[model samples]
Target: DQQVKQNSPSLSVQEGRISILNCDYTNSMFDYFLWYKKYPAEGPTFLISISSIKDKNEDGRFTVFLNKSAKHLSLHIVPSQPGDSAVYFCATQRGGSEKLVFGKGTKLTVNP
Candidate 1:
């Protein structure tokens, strides 16, 4: 089953603009949602995350919003910078589980 999906394969944004990445999941039992950024040939790095119990979580310029009703989650990057360019993956894990399920990925490019 395709539990997680990223509709957009790529997104482009100009520096100093907002960048939004979207993700959808079919599993309601998922307790946590995470967004990871990966550079080419490099391992994915944790970007931001949100819990199912919370509607929104923010850290600096990155914010994650979760809508349990629609089973949707999105990551918002404000004033996107050139350094923010990378492939983004959406992931989820249920309670008491160590395994993480990830979507294919969405490549983000920020142009100066």
Candidate 2:
């Protein structure tokens, strides 16, 4: 059973625009939301994360928003660049657990 889902398999955005990637989870026990970016031939790298208690977290041009009541989360990138093009994975982790449950991922393509 897929606990986490990225409904949109792919999203395309113009360079210098905003990119939004969405995810939903069925497990309410998850207390952490993690976003990972993976380029071709490379492993997924941690991009941004948010705690269940927090509604939003921002790092540089990336921001993650969590809606615990909806079990939904989104990652937004402002002024998206070509380098931002990658497969984004949405992961959920329960408090104190090292295990991460990941969604299939959404491919983001930023055109210049």
Runs off by more than 4 Å, candidate 1: none
Clashing pairs in 2: none
What would the per-residue lDDT of candidate 1 be over residues 2-112, giving only the tens digit for each residue? 999999999999999999999999988999999999999999999888888899999999999999999999999998999999999999999989999999999999999
| Tens digit per residue, CA lDDT, model 2, 54-92 | 999999999999999999999999989999999999999
Error of 1 at 53 (Å): 1.0
- Which candidate has the top score in lDDT? 2
Q: How high a TM-score does candidate 1 get?
A: 0.98
What residue runs in model 2 are displaced by over 4 Å at the alpha carbon?
Answer: none
lDDT score at residue 101, model 2, on the 0-100 scale: 98
